[model samples]
Each structure stands twice: as structure tokens, then as C-alpha cells.
Target chain A: MKLPADVVSKKNGKHTIQPLSDPKIEAKDLDFFYSEKKALSDVTITIPSNRVTGLIGPSGCGKSTFLRCLNRMNDIIPGTRVQGKILLDGQDIYAPDMDVVQLRCRVGMVFQKSNPFPKSIYDNVAYGLRVNGWKDRREIEAKVEQSLRHAAIWEEVKDRLKSSALDLSGGQQQRLCIARALAIQPEVLLMDEPASALDPIATARIEDLIQELKKDYTIVIVTHNMQQAARVSDFTAFFYLGQIIEFDRTEVIFTNPRQQRTEDYVTGRFG
Target chain B: MRLLPKSFKANKRERGIELFLLFCASVSILTTLGIVAVLLFETVDFFREVSIVSFFTDTEWTPLFAQKRFGIWPLLIGTILISGIAMLVALPAGLLSSLYLSEYAPDRVRRVVKPVLEILAGIPTVVYGYFALLFVTPLLQKFLPGLSGFNALSPGIVMGIMILPLVSSLSEDAMQAVPRSLREGAYALGSTNLQVSFRIVIPAAFSGITASFILAVSRAIGETMIVAIAAGQQPRLTANPLVPIETMTAYIVQVSMGDTPVGTLEYKTIFVVGMMLFLSTLVLNVLSQRLRARFREVYR
Candidate 1:
């Protein structure tokens, strides 16, 4: 397949593909509405594969709404409407032919608050696989172990796999939710402020886990803390009043922005 | 000493109101204690005439007849059989309706449907008895050929309908108490609506659902008017629900309506049966409360 020129840039004339430079998801002229009020207007951005993209803005700036759009989570809210094209792997996700359940499987999500099911830790992680029709007990168990190990919560939870997920500490519960999301083996992960509720130690653990996860999966995270964006993300998008003010490499966004609004916001002048 | 300002001092009127509220609370406690005392005193009198072993073990109960028998199994069996039939009708119907109301119904539909269903509960139990005798018994006889004119089946079905709203509303509350976050989490994992409702939401709300079921069972046990009218006054120790049987509540109502002497053996039997009903419901209510506490702890 011929990659779109704007989406895939080259170092030289040689044909080479780096996953960081390849666009995995593209949103074009996206306008979102909750009933009659507009939440996101004419927003366009591309998320690259195998890279962490950070979305940072104040509350109600539509960063979380935009993250939910990738997995079509907004569809659950009654009276919410969307008018745009969200393409995943060059296919428009909002197309009539798209299977939303399958799309969600491909693009999994973690919420601002960790929500572990009121079930044993093992059952919580295996829930996705079971719903997707994995009936073999041994296969489900192996996948649960692998996902827990991948989320870096295996050592703390392996001994108490039968214990309720709610019994885990706040940080461990968040990691269990991540493992639950990962057990489905999604290509992209959408995290809406996954560490906002945790303490400093737990926040640091989640940050480290995100870094390790970006090697295998595409990650798009929405955060209020610019420091977290600078530490974790390869690419950054700054949203202001339902619009993307700037999209660039994280270092450039932090130090050398072309737009005055971006510069003012980066310097902590005002939201 | 400086004079205390009005704002800094407790108001006498508020104190009076607090005393009145405490008095109101004590009234309910006093009523419960009074009921327990009556049951204990009358039960002692009845046990003096009848042996405990005969009351429990002997299957036939013919207390008002010439050749009187004091066996309690007939009344106990009738209570159990009617309650069993009522639960068979109520639990599935009530739970399914609640699941539909809470999980699937649109806002407009739920607004209209819920009150209409609760209307069933607001109807007087006496009215339910007449409906069981007139409408339900005849309708059931068409399909169940062996059903009697006055059988446990009709009253059981009618009583189940009477308690349907109780089960539906309480179970719906429990299901709704399962957080929206849990459903969203399940949806994000690619679960269909059915999968999310059954696997995640239902299991999370299990204890509350069980509590509601127990409450419904207790309500069925204490029901009287429907069984008194539709189920005949004969007390038989039979498991078959098609036959006429008399429940404990029905016998109490029967004895109360007649001009029995104050200290008669028949009058004392009412208290004995009342004690049994009270103790069973007491145990069920305690279990329901414990389950509710465990459920609350899970989410917290």
C-alpha cells in the first residue's frame, strides 16, 4: 500500500518504514455534539503507530471526548452526535459497515477512574477473552497471566488471583484494569487520565508501565498535567476550547512552539 | 459572667421537637415488644393443652372438629406450598421485568411503565382475594383440568402478582446501584449489551437481588386475604398445590372473624401460628440486611 505523503515522511529517498512515522489513526474535520451544543469542532489529528501521543487541556476542553471518539465510547451516551471521519488503519471507523464491537476490541480504553469489576482478579482480566468467545479454560488462564505480566502487576497479584479485584490498592486496581484491557490484545490503547486518581508513587508506576506498553501498542493518553505529557509522550496535541491548537513532537511543543497561544499556555500564562 | 447570646445557645423549641421525635421512635419499639409478649403468653397457654411433638409431627389438623387433631404440619405445609408456587410465578417475572426496566427501557418507556406495574401492588389484598376467586381460578381451571374451585394455585398466582411490584422495584434499585463505570468498562472490552447486563451488572448486583428475593418470600409468607378467600378453609398436609389448603395467616383471619371465647384453645392457636410466621420473617429480614451490608462493602 502506498502511504499518504503527509502521514509518512522519509529521512532520505530510500524506502524505509519506521512505526513511529506511520500513522495508525487519523481524524478529519471531526465535529462532535452533545444534543445541540458542540463539544469538539473541526478537529483533525493523526496518531502514529507504536508511539505514545499525549492530549493535554483543561477540564471540558474536549480532550477526553476526543479520546473516547477513537473507540466510539460516546455512542453510549444518549443524544450525543458525531459528524466526521475517524479512520483506524486507513479505514473510517464511523462508516456504516463498521462493527462497533470489533472496533472497540481493536481500540481498548482505560478511564480516568479505575473501574475493576466486583469479581476475582483472574476473572476480571479474563472477562474480555470470554466475551469474545474464548471457551478453553487453559487458554484463558494463560492469556490472563500474560496480560497481567505485560501490565507489570503479576508479582503483586499472582498469589491472590482468586481474590476480588476491588481488594487491591488503588494503583494495583488501575494496573488490573490495564491488564483487563490488554487481555483482549488491542492494537491501540486510549487512556483518559489513568493516573489522575493515584498518589505520586502509584502515578510513577503507571507512567513507567505506559512507556513499556508503547513498544507494542499505540497509546493515546489524555492528561491535565503537562509534566506527565513531557515525560511520557513522543507526540503531543494541545487542545483549547474543543480545538487542537498545536500538534508536534513533545520536545518542540514544550520548548519551541510556533503559535503564540501554544507558547503562552506552555509557559503557564493561562488555560 | 457575661450573658450568653441567643445564637450561641440551644433553642428550647428545638429541644422540644427532638423530644417529640424520640417519643415517636419509642412508639414503634413499644409496639414490637407488645407483640412479642402477646405471642409468648398465648403460646404458653396453647402448649399446656397440646404436646410440641404432636403439634409438629402429626400430619392431620382438625382442631374445630368433633375428633380434633392438633398437628401443625397441615398449616405449615399449606404455607410452604402456597409460598413455593408464588415464588415460582414471581421471581422470574419480577427479575426479568426489573432487568428490562433498569437496563434496557428507554427513559420515556420506563417513566410510563414503572408506575403502571407498581399499581398492581397498590391494590388492596382483599381485592386481590376476590380477583383470585372470580377471575384467576376460572382462568386457571381451563388449562389445569384437575384444579379445584378453591385451590392453592389460584391464590398463589394472585399473591405473586400482588407482590410483583415489590420485587421489581427493589431488584431494579439493586441493579441500578451497580455503577455506570462497570458497564462502561465492560463495553470498552467489546462486550455486547447482553454480555454487559448479564455477566458484569447482574453479578455485581447479586447480593441486592438476593435480598429482594428474600423480602418477597417473607411478604408471601405473611399474605392472608388471597389464600383465605381462594384457598378453602381445609388444612391438609399435602404437597400438591392443586388441592385446597389453609395457611397460617388464613387460620388467624378465620378465628378472628368468629366469636371464639377469649381464653379458648382455638384462640391460643392463632398466637402460636403468629409466632411461627414472625420468627421466620425475622430470620429472613436479618439475612437480607446482612447481604445488603456485604454488597455495600464491595463497592465501597
Candidate 2:
């Protein structure tokens, strides 16, 4: 199927088509609201298959709200109203025929703070599988191991499957969250400042993990740290006050922004 | 001279009031200590008269009468049976109610449901006893066989209902304390509301839940009027709750019904039984406190 150009990827250092050649998700004129206040305004963006795209802005610029709109996570918030179109795999997701449960399975998310369940590491990863109806003990174990391996946390946690996930180091716990998401094998992974909760070293590990994971899954990350975004993302979208002021390859957006507001914000003149 | 010439130089009357308040505070603490000391002394005295084995294992509980048998098992078993029933009914319903309040119920529904449940707590135990005797016993008799007018089932069920607010309120606080970030994390992974609550939030808040549970159980044990009025003072050692049984508090009330001469072994039984109840709750309270201390996250 011919896919609309992922407008978010028009920025520099923006990578090429997926080896599979199909866009996983597309959003057209997407608007989001929390009661009377609009959090996202006419923002159209696309999440390409198997690439790391970063959304950067200051607090409440609607980056997180937009990310939430991708998987319908904002629906739980009282008075949250969303409009326009969100598509997954050339199918219009907002078209009333969508199944939210299947949409969530196909697209997963991680958060700013590392939230490893208080149970054993094995159970934490095993949770999503069980909910999706995986019943066999052997299959659950193998899947947990496989997911942890994909998140690059398997070797460290292999000997301690029964140990509480909370007992792991902060970096490891963040990776465990990734593994838990990976356990469901989603097509798109949305991360909202997944590294902000970590120390520098831990942040570096997560950055590396994100870079590696993009080869197999699409990644959309929201970060306030411009350097981290420039370093890790293949493409970057700079959002300001509920608008995508500029979006392009990371190099172009940094060295040669098309919009003046994007340059001033990039240079720390005004947020 | 310099040390004495501090800020209160012009406030002698205030100083006197401060000293008086300090004295009152000390007196309150001392009064508590004095009461504990008295209970301890009398309890030890009673233990000397009644062997520990007899206190724990005796099946009959009459002490003031000529046929006085001091085996405390009847009262102990009765207390356990009622508390057991209370916990059995309270735990699941209370936890689920808390989960719904925290996770599922809408704000408007929560405002209504929460107060409705807490209203259970506001009604006096005596009122609960009356309701148990007058209403619950009759209702239970339709389905349950041999459920006497003052069977343990009515009182225990009423006590369980009475403690619902305690369990729901506390467990809700515990679940709330599990951190919204943890819940957000669970949801980002595509977890359902129940999955996020039961798997992540509940276990993360386990210590608080444990503390809440122990507190509920203690409340159930210490409850008296309902059992006294609804569960007759039979003092049986059986778990057949459909029949009447006399709990320890009810036994104390039974002895106190008429003048059991003070300082007699009969009057002293009150103190001994009181000590046992006190000690049991004390241990559970301490355990709950320690569990909360060890597991509570210090969020900076």
C-alpha cells in the first residue's frame, strides 16, 4: 500500500524507508484536548516503521499528550477529547471500527520514570503475555527470556528470574520495562522521556538500547534534553506550545532550522 | 545570668502555663504507664492461680458460679471464630472495593460510594448489635439451618460489614500510595486496569496492605457489643458459627452482668482475658508497623 510520507521524517538525519517498505502509523491533523484546554492543535505527524523518531520540547508542550494519543492512552483521563485521524498500518485508527485492545498490542509505550512491577523479574515480563492469552508455562518462560534478551537485559537477569524487578539497578529496571513492552512484540514503541529518570550512566545505556532496538521496531521518544535527542534519534520533531514548530533530520533542525522560533528555542533564547 | 535572660523574660505567666502543660503531658504518659502496670500486676496474679495450659485449653468458661470451670478455650475459640468470619468476609470485598474506588470508579461515583461505605463506620457498635439481633438473624435463618436467634453468624457478619470501611479506606490509601508513575508504566505496556492494579499496584503497596489488614483484624477482635447482643454467651469450643458462642469480651460482659466479687478469681478472669486480647493486638500492631517501616518507599 502507498503510505503518506511520514511528515515527521522530513527533518535532517531522518532515515530511509523501512526494509519492509510500509509505514506503521500515521496521524493527520491530530488534535487533543483535556476538557476545554487543547493540548495538541492540528498536529500531523507520522511514525515510520523500524526507525527512532524523537519529539523534543519543554514541559506541557503536548509532546507527551501527542504520544499518548498514538495508543489511545489519553482516553482514561477524564474530559480528554481527541479529534482527527490516527492510522496504524494504512488503516484509519480513529475511524470507529478500531479495536483499542488490538491497537495497544500492536503499539506499546514506556514512561519517564522506570516502573518495574514489584514482583519477580520473570513475572513482570510474563504479565503482558498472560493478558494476551498465552497460557502455557513453558511458552511464558521462553517468551520472557526472549523479550529480556531483545531488551539486552537477559544475561544480567537470567540467573535471577525470581528476584523482584524492583531489586534491579535503575538502568536495569528501565530495560526491564522495555523488555516487558517487547514481550508483546509491538510494531511501534512510544517512550515519554524514558531516560530522564536515570543517572547519566543509566541514561547512556538506555540511549544505546533505543538505538539498537530501532532496527526491529519503530521508536517514538519524547525528551527535553536536546543533546540526547540529537544523539539517539534518526529524525527529530521540535514541538512548542502544542505545535510542531519545525521537524526535519536532526542535523538540519539543529544547524539550519527553517522556522525562527525553532532556532530561538534551540539556542535557549526563550522556551 | 545571660542564659536565664532569654526570650521569656517578660512572660512569667506564659512560662507558668508552659510548665503546667508539660506537667499535664507527663501525667498523661504516666497514667498510661500506670494503667499498663496495674493490668500487668493483676494479670500475673491471675496466672499464678490459673495454669497457662488451663487458660489456653480449658473448654468451659464459667468462673463465678459454684460449678466454675476456668478452661479459657471456649472464649478463645469463640473470639477466633468470629474474627475469622469477619476477615473471611472483609478481605476480598474490602480489597476489591478499594481497587474499584481507586482505579475504576468515576469521581462522581467515588464521592457517593466512599461516603456510603464510610457511613458503615459511623453507626455505633450498639446499633450494629441491635441490627444484628433484630434483622440479620432473621434473614440468615432462611438459608442457614439451626441458626439460633443469637448465633455467631449474625454477629460475625455484622462485624464484617462494620469493618468494611476500615479495610476499604486503608487499602485504598495503600493502593493510592503505590505511585501513579507505576500505574502509568503498567498501562504503557498495554495492561488492563485490573492487571495494573492487582499485579503492579497491589504488590508494590503490599506492606501498607498488610498493615491495613492487621488493623482490620484487630478491630474485629476488639469489637464487643455486636457479639454480646447477637452471639449468645454460650462459650462453646466449636467452630459451628451457626450456633451461639461466647467470645472473650462477651464472657467478661457475662461475668460483669452480675457482681462477681472484685479480686476473686472470677473478677480476675476479666483482667487475664483482657491481657490476652491486649497482647494479641499489640503483637499484630507491632508487626504491621515494622512491615510498613521496612517496605515503605522514601520518595525524595
Candidate 3:
């Protein structure tokens, strides 16, 4: 349980820092750029293990960009670059020796729009396992079933596992995407507005699922809804114009935020 | 109780414009029907003189010989052999190049290379015919000394290269149409670039790739100039690629350019061959259209 050097140094400083019981991910001075335009500047945050950390921000606030940076998903975009370090459990993920494929295996993600493969529900859930070289048929089947149950969509889809995933309703499809991510058994799960496109009841189901998921997995969620952040996250980080304005406990952020901007945003003032 | 005045002149002008547009749209359709009608009538005339059973069952196709024969197996086998060889060469190479273009190439590189590759499609097929006869055949002869100067392999390989652009361009377009979110999902699941390509992108673009393959094969079946010049005018029912052969289109070309008298049965043979070629391509085109429609529905 060795702490990352930056976190250790910050703990000894003058600022009253709440001690993280176990920090699973730490970004130190992370600056992101898409070609010439800067998207994130000097972002430094510590995400605790087995807890839901919510990122709340307005449009173009770099919350989604920050979530993608956790798993280096932005590397796929041409002319995008990252400066500084993102340490997953004490290892630098951006280090030259770090394998991107292995990093992704440990850090899985669900997108805003549910993008199930043009395949069956069973196949979609089993894709990550097969690609990772899983050979045992029974094991894969068990894992797919377990993941679907964990995502709370097992009973809805168990009878139709072989049917095309596209036939599912929007909420079911999003839950299926969550199951797909869960089948890989990553240490950390990143969700980018997983319920933005869903209705209120569907959104409630997702929020409850997040609460259940944090028992074993470190969850980082980017959401535009302040209430969602308040409901699901243990810790909340507020971002504006690509910089973090405040990071505190969820109730502290919602009820007694230090910054005026945080209060304005939480109170439905101005974004 | 008229709410507004109706202008008869304006209504008449609108009707006139609609009729003009309809006529323009029907021009191509009318021309296609005219061609099909001509082919059908001429094919009927050819069938009247030559019995239908022998036309298909006979193994020899020496309609211009002293003892006339009407077996189409030789020409049909020749067409299959050459087109099969062409597909063997084109399918893998075209699909690999398309994968490279869609998934690997940088934006700047793709912009330059894609248009350059398409230039191959613009090159005249007649030039490709001579290239097969003069350049490729001689080059192939160095390694394969037993290769004939006018053989199926030379033109088949050349025809593959000639049609390579069509397959790659269309396949690349299909692969590129796969959404970025799908690719990101795969990548986020610990899949490498190659894995994402083979497991996700290719499957997503399956119908498009299949359609491209069918269209390319149909084009190869309809190709005349290259096989006519390099495959020789000898219609032999054999599978060997290193021998002279005559495809269906090549046979039609040979007969049409020969001194066969008009209104004779020998002269009418070209239309029958033409009808077969038209039908094969028509079926392939319809099949490709269906596959493309399915692809659109899935992705749209």
C-alpha cells in the first residue's frame, strides 16, 4: 500500500487534505491538447479505490476529456496529445514500458451513447473475454451471466441472449453496454454520461447500479446533472473551462461548497 | 367558397416542369429496356436455328468451323476459370489494402494514396490488355518457362490488377463508414489495433465488403478487351491457367469482329453470348444492391 510520491508530498503540505484510504488512480498536472487547442490544463486529482468519484461540469468543460484520459482513450484521435502522468495503482500508465492493451484491460469504460457491437447480447458481453484469449466455454458463459446480473439487466435479457443487441430498448442497450464492460473485470470503470440519453427512471436505475458497483470496483463518472452527482458519488470534482474548480466530499460539494462557482452550479444558477 | 385564387398558368408551368423531370429520369430506363429487348429478340432468333439442349450440352463451340458445333461449355468454363483466377488475386489484396487505408493510414497519407489508387480504375482497359500480352506474360514466363504467350493466367492477373481499385475503393468506403464509437468500445476493452480491426470493424462492415466483392467479380465476368487480346480466341473446356482460352465476352468479341455474314446463324451467336453475359451481370448487380441495402439499414 505504497502511496504515489505526489500524494505523499501533498499530505505533508499546509493544505488540510482528507486522507484517501486507498487511492487507485492519481493524475499529476495532466494537460491535454487536441492539436493546438488546449482542452485540459494542469489537472491534478486523486480518485479513491472502490468508491464512486463523480465529475460535474458544463458543456466543453473537459469532464468527458478527463474521463477518456483515465484510460488513454483519446490516443485514437489524431493530433491529440497528453502531458504529465496518470498513475493507475502506483504505476505510470503513460510510461514507455506500459502496454496500452494491458492498461485498457485494467481500466474499462462505458460511453455516453450505448454502442453495442452489431452482434448478439451474449456475443457482445463475451467479446472482451474472447479477445483476451478466454478459451473455456463454460467460464465465459458464467462470466457473461454474472456481468448481466450485476448490471441489473439479466432477467430482462437472459431469455434472449442470442438475439441481436440492437433490438433492445435504449435503456436496456445502455445496461447491456455496462454488462459488456463488467465482463472484462477491470479494476476501474469509467462512465461518460451513461444515463444522459436515458429517461428519468432509466437514469435512476443506473444511479442505483453505480451505488451497488462501488463495493468492488473504483468508479469514475462524468455527468451534467448535479443531482446525479450528489446521488451517486462519494467524492465530487467540479470543473469549468478545462480546470478543476473544487474537489470535495459529495455532500460538502452540494451543501457547503467553498467556491461561489460551485454553489452557483449546484443551486441551478449559471453553468 | 374559395379561400384563395388558383392560378391556372402557374399550375400548368409546374406540371410542365414535373413532366420534364420525369422524362429525364426515364431516359436511362428506356435505353436499358431497348437494349434488353434487342438482346432477347436476337437470342430468340439464334435459339430457333440451334437446338437449346445442344447449345448447353455440347462441349465444342466451333460455330464457324466446316462442321458447326454449338456447345457452350468451352466458353463458360473459360469464363469461370479466368474470373476465378482474377478473384483469387484481387480479393485478398484488395481487402488488405482497404483495411490499411481505413484503419491504419494517417489522414494526410490516405488523402493522397486513395486518389492515386483510384487512378488505376481510370486507366483504359485496352492498355491493360496490351500490358498483359507484352509485359506481364513475358515477366511470368521467366519463372514459368512453360507459360504460353496467350494464356489465361496473364490476362487474369492483369484483369485483377485493373479491377483492384474498384474493390479497394468501395471496401475502404464501407470500413470507413463504421462509427468511431464502435472502434473506441473495442479499444477500451483491451483490444489492440489489429484485434479491433479484425474482430469489430471487419464484422461491422461485412455486408459492404461482401457487396464490393460481388461487384468486382461481376466486373471481371463482363471484362472483354483484356481476355480478348491475351486469352486467345480458342474456346477449350479446361481448368489450366497456362493455356489459351476464350471467355464468353471474348467469344462475342471474336464473332462480332469476324467476317460472318449478317442474318446467318453463325453471326447471331454473338447476341446469344451477349444475352448470357448481360444476365450474369444483372443478377450480380441485384445481389450486391441487396447486400448494400442491408448494410445501410444496420448502420443507419
At residue B233, candidate 3 shows an lDDT of 88
Write down the RMSD of candidate 2 (Cα, Å): 3.6
Model 3 lDDT at residue A176: 95
lDDT of 2 by residue, B210-257 (tens): 888888898888889999999998888898989989998887788888
Give the number of the best model, judged by lDDT: 3
Q: Judged by TM-score relative to the true structure, which candidate is superior, 1 or 2? A: 1
Q: For model 2, how does the per-residue alpha-carbon lDDT over A216-270 read when each residue is reduced to its tens digit?
A: 8999999999899889986778888898877776777788888888788778887
Residue B79 Cα positional deviation in candidate 1, in Å, after optimal superposition: 1.1
TM-score of each: 0.94, 0.90, 0.95
In model 2, where do residues sit more than 4 Å from their true spots? A1-22, A95-97, B1-22, B298-300
Mark the 10 consecutive residues where model 3 chain A has the least summed lDDT: A1-10
Sorted by TM-score, highest first, which candidate order results? 3, 1, 2
Candidate 1 lDDT, A1-271, residue by residue in tens: 1122232233578644444457899999999999999999999998888889999877898999999999999988878999989999999999999999999999999998999998899999999999999999999999999999999999999999999898899999999999999999999999999999999999999999999998899999999888999999988888999999888878778999877888888789987
Give all candidate RMSDs, comma-separated: 3.1, 3.6, 4.1
User: Candidate 1, residues B42-93: lDDT per residue as tens digits?
Assistant: 9988999999999988888887777878888899989999998899889999
